[model samples]
Target: MKILKSTLIATTLLMGISCKTSNNHKAQETGLRDAYKNSFHVGTALNRDDILQTDSLRSALIGKEFSSITAENIMKSMFMHPEKDVYQFDMSDKYVEFGEKNNMFIHGHTLIWHSQLAPWMRSISDSTEMAQAMESHIKTIVEKYKGRINSWDVVNEALNEDGTLRNSAFYKTIGSEYLAMAFKWAAETDPNTDLYYNDYNLTNKAKRAGAVKLVKDIQSKGIKIDGVGMQGHWHIDSPSIEEIEESILDYANLGVKVAITELDVSVLPNPWNLVGAEISQNFENNKKLNPYPEALPDSMQVKLAKRYSDIFKVFLKHQDKISRVTFWGTSDKESWLNDFPVRGRTNYPLLFDRELKPKAAYDSILALKK
Candidate 1:
């Protein structure tokens, strides 16, 4: 009887220890911000619903997993300054307040871009008028959020795939010099904030060359050009790991920091192999295209896990040049790729699944330092 009682006590002690261990592990799984704490700033772009605090689970997940926030669309020209005579700062105030309350690094997505421009801004004809308008736009926004927003994508997607200006209204009326002008006005308004010239497909030589030239031109004029945001709208394997690393180093060589901005690895097949994140692109929603409309295959989940691991390995290698690695959205459900290029296609591109649960991709990223 005594022997049996001793054995039972030992078993109970072991069970208690195991339960404690499991509880501790569950508490530790706060995701990216905790996993990559020392490596770089982990962030997500906030959708309107997220900023408005409408989704409690998402807001909590964002606070737990991310150390930074980007205004996905609220700060853009179309949303914030839709009408020529009107500028909306109400929704934006909530965004800033959320970031402040959480102590997350707040960032402004863009000051100027051709796509998503208000119709009024696009219709300007005179060079002088356009320049004056840009000056007001940059200065007003920067001054409003000067001390709060640590960085600004001062000029976004300004380079063509072939390393030429996009012939945007800013470029058309003000010439390519408008690129420098935008950055200059932004810097003068808030020199303390990190000024970034953001664009996509930095792995492409022509676009890379164009960005290097643009930054160098600004620097030559003794203006501030702090970093380059290499928008990480990558696929499962299209952009070779070598190309990504090369671009990171190339941008670092230009005497500027680098950021892997707007990151999301799409598992879906690209409609036309779209190279950049142009908001105007779309396609008819065919059943064939939205193959994973309801649920993703188990095999593809493994592929996504491996892809995230590989990309993060490169990011860890070039941590010196990179400032932040921001996911475009917090969960797979919120990924804009779902409706971009084609609407109604389910895209499992983010770290968390639709239920706001972490996936194997999350585990893979966490295992990088191991």
Candidate 2:
């Protein structure tokens, strides 16, 4: 495939050329976006917006590339089951329907997690009841969207920072067996959809080894595991490039597809200043960048874009092992970083600035060539 150039003039020229062309459209043209177009499945998790009414965002993605739509909070156990015994499917089903309508693949955010589980799920004392509930929930959700959802996060953050099974509710009730059971039940429910294990900090040596062992262990038990999702939540300075590339290879060596899920580079208060007064507050336009500031420092923002582009460069080099790459949020305004660590602090950590305009990172992503 010929790589698309990132220049505005080149993009306009390509768009015009692609508009008049038909038979020659490549995978990068028809199904995915060219490197210059942010085409590697650019997407955002949705909750409140009506799929039919999201013309603004829909129009924006027309020529951009994206892999799938991930129902971030929608698919999480807590969001699906805010109350005990009363599961909601309206929102999630809408999300999948939207993806299908837009010719976008759908990825289930998660089936199991230590966080965001139903309240009653936490109170279950009997192993049988816990296992039954888990199986039922997984079966119901997976079956409901079987053909529609192309991929699923079978388990989320299952391992501790040290790479051991987290003593979460599921582990406490059914032991480590729950991981295998969750994948088995999900696969049984939807034999075609890809199943994945997703987590953060997989770039660390111990964490990477733990993920490798987890995949091998699950495969050893004859479970239907298909992928490993690395939550690429990097900061401007952390998660060295060497660690990121090595982790991708480790997961692939175990015979599972790898994905950079929940990718975003946090440009908040620097980590070194974590103990001091919050540094994020100093960036006055942080909270959603309301009333876009004119004459902002171009160099700092350019550096930020380079950071994102560098990561994409790494991703492109390992595209053989990677199956998908999903951005965490649609815009910097909607990023989770704003509230994380310190609530109400503004942070810029995504491809688009507050005005839905592409940042320098956009230039870098477009700079990628096949």
Candidate 3:
């Protein structure tokens, strides 16, 4: 890891252009800042810059008052069980250590998900064995990080677009009841930790309703759930502001912590093609590549930044309900938005650009002073 002369970078941003005048709407409300000064947890996924070979990225993060650390894929079941029964904790442990070392809150990404599960988990046939295995895995992982992790996303993306349970292996075997059980077990296993249900594409009425019902069901069962994580993977155009606000309000109504997790706004050619696929692949490689042709132009980048600013401003307005805001990765170089669903599509969907410099989006977010 090479050290970046951040003094130079900060100077450049300061001199890039005059600061734009902010509308009163963007201004912090009275006491809002002090009330939740440290509560607004801005974060991103663990990346190569922070972990590969140096602390240059970590040093960069230190300058910002980040609220927490998101493990992203590190805490996923697949990463933890890459070879089936062979749990490797090296990388994920390093990240957890990094969070504690920095005194940043740690968000354990997912305990259950449909996409990242190992084949063995999906291949199990006997119901008894499956349930027992699920219990063992959850108990072991939760117990291992009992004191260290303050929050755990016990279930991730379990709802389909129509609010039905996705036919994940867990659902196939344990049925929808698994969600309630998972939350209950997690609370029992780590009584001090907050349990959350995490999901993407939740900025819609159907999905929001489904989530509310799920949370209600768990609570009705006397479960000790604490929060709901909305994976804020938005497009530049879709997921209208009304929808976003509604989603937040709906979840907050449940009396739980609402988090904007895995946030990134994609700006690229529509319909998502093969070039997008290549871009996604390259993003994970952690090496520099040519920017995607359809990426936001400089003007678009500014618009994107302003969009994030507006959203953060809204988040501040609802600070009483929201607890955390996490970007998907440190910079465009490491964001999962680049490689997911589509591969090689170039996109600038985060607060930082490839250079690790705070783009307008960064300033826009910081402007939300209490």
lDDT of each: 0.86, 0.72, 0.71
Cα lDDT tens digits for candidate 2, 1-370: 2444445544564454334332234332432354523434555555454343465664345325454678768778777876657789878877777777777868898888877777878788799999998888899888888788899999998887678888889898899889899999998899899999999888877777788888888999998899999987778777878878888888988888998888888766553343211223333335443322342244445556668767887888887778888878766777777765556666677766677555556545654554
Give, for candidate 3, the lowest lDDT window spanning 10 residues.
274-283
Q: On a 0 to 100 scale, what is the lDDT of residue 53 in model 1?
A: 91
Model 1 residue 365 distance off true place after TM-score fit, in angstroms: 0.4
Task: Please estimate how well model 2 matches the true structure, expressed as its whole-model Cα lDDT.
Answer: 0.72
Tell how far residue 235 is off in model 1, in angstroms: 0.6
lDDT of residue 47 for candidate 1: 92
Comparing 1 with 3 on TM-score, the higher-scoring candidate is 1
Error of 2 at 354 (Å): 0.4
Query: Model 1 clash tally?
Result: 0
On a 0 to 100 scale, what is the lDDT of residue 341 in model 1? 80
**CA error at residue 362 for candidate 1, angstroms:** 0.7
Candidate 1 RMSD computed on C-alpha atoms after optimal superposition onto the true structure: 8.0
Ranked candidates (TM-score, high to low): 1, 3, 2
- What alpha-carbon RMSD in Å does predicted model 3 have with respect to the real structure? 8.2
- Going through the candidates in the order shown, the clash numbers are 0, 7, 17
What is model 2's C-alpha RMSD? Answer: 7.4
On a 0 to 1 TM-score scale, where does candidate 1 land against the true structure?
Answer: 0.91
